[model samples]
Target: MEITNLETLPGKQIIAHFGLVSGSTVRAKHFGKDFLAGLKNIVGGELKSYTDLLNEARDEAINRMLNQAKSKGANAVINVRFSTSSVAQGASEIYCYGTAVKVS
Candidate 1:
């Protein structure tokens, strides 16, 4: 399916609007990674562990969003957006949302 942050797809015409669709997931850092992050903080470098975690979360959220769009019989999703928030001490939420539409 085609997904874009813009209101409309570049070459496709939006024929039907199915309103809003969304997906989200929550994840927490592993203890080992937490310890590594602490050490990295002292040395001041990239946190690869956390980066990987967020990347995986983003993919999962996008897959879920696509599943929702497909279930709605939509060929595309427009105005796609992502949101991240801390829901707990070590856990964060990843959310993806968009307007489901049929394109032709």
Candidate 2:
């Protein structure tokens, strides 16, 4: 499905609105990754391990949201947004949401 942060998709007209759709995932830092991250922090560089984890989590959340929109007969999702929050001491939640719509 076409997903965009804009309220409207270029060259496409919204035919119907299916309210809101959302998906979320909670992920915890792996011990091995945490150890690597700590070492990277000491050197003050990018933490590849943690960065990969977040990227995967974000993709999963977006996929789930797209599935929900598809199930609702939506061809696209507009005004897509993402959020992140600490769910626990070591766990974080990634959420994606948007307005499901049919466009043509």
Candidate 3:
């Protein structure tokens, strides 16, 4: 399904609004990755491990949100937004939300 951060899709018209749909997941850094990230911190470089982990989490959250929208018979999701917060010392929660809409 098409997803956008804009309130409405450019060329599509919203035919129905299905309120809100959301998905969230919490992920923790792997021990091995954490150890490597610590070493990288000393060199003051990008932490590729953590970056990959977060990217994966974001994709998972988006996929879940899309699934929910699809279940509601939505063809697209508008006003999509993402949020991230620390759930614990080494864990973080990723959330995605949007308005499910049937567009034509």
lDDT of 3 by residue, 1-104 (tens): 99999999999889999999999999999798898888888898788888888999999999999999999999999999999999899898999999999999
Report each candidate's C-alpha RMSD, comma-separated, in the order given.
0.8, 0.9, 0.7
| lDDT string, candidate 1, 37-104, tens digits | 88999989789999999999999999999999999999999999999999998788999999999999
Q: Which ten contiguous residues of candidate 2 have the minimum total lDDT?
A: 45-54
Candidate 1 has a TM-score of 0.96
Candidate numbers sorted by TM-score from highest down = 3, 1, 2
Model 2 regions lying over 4 Å from their true place: none
lDDT against true structure, model 2: 0.92
Residue 1 Cα positional deviation in candidate 3, in Å, after optimal superposition:
0.2
Indicate the residue-level lDDT of 5 in model 1: 100
Query: How high is the lDDT of residue 47 in model 3?
Result: 82
The residue pairs that clash in candidate 1, if any, are none
TM-score winner among the candidates?
3
Give model 2's TM-score versus the native structure: 0.95
Candidate 3 stretches greater than 4 Å from native: none
* C-alpha RMSD between model 2 and the true structure: 0.9
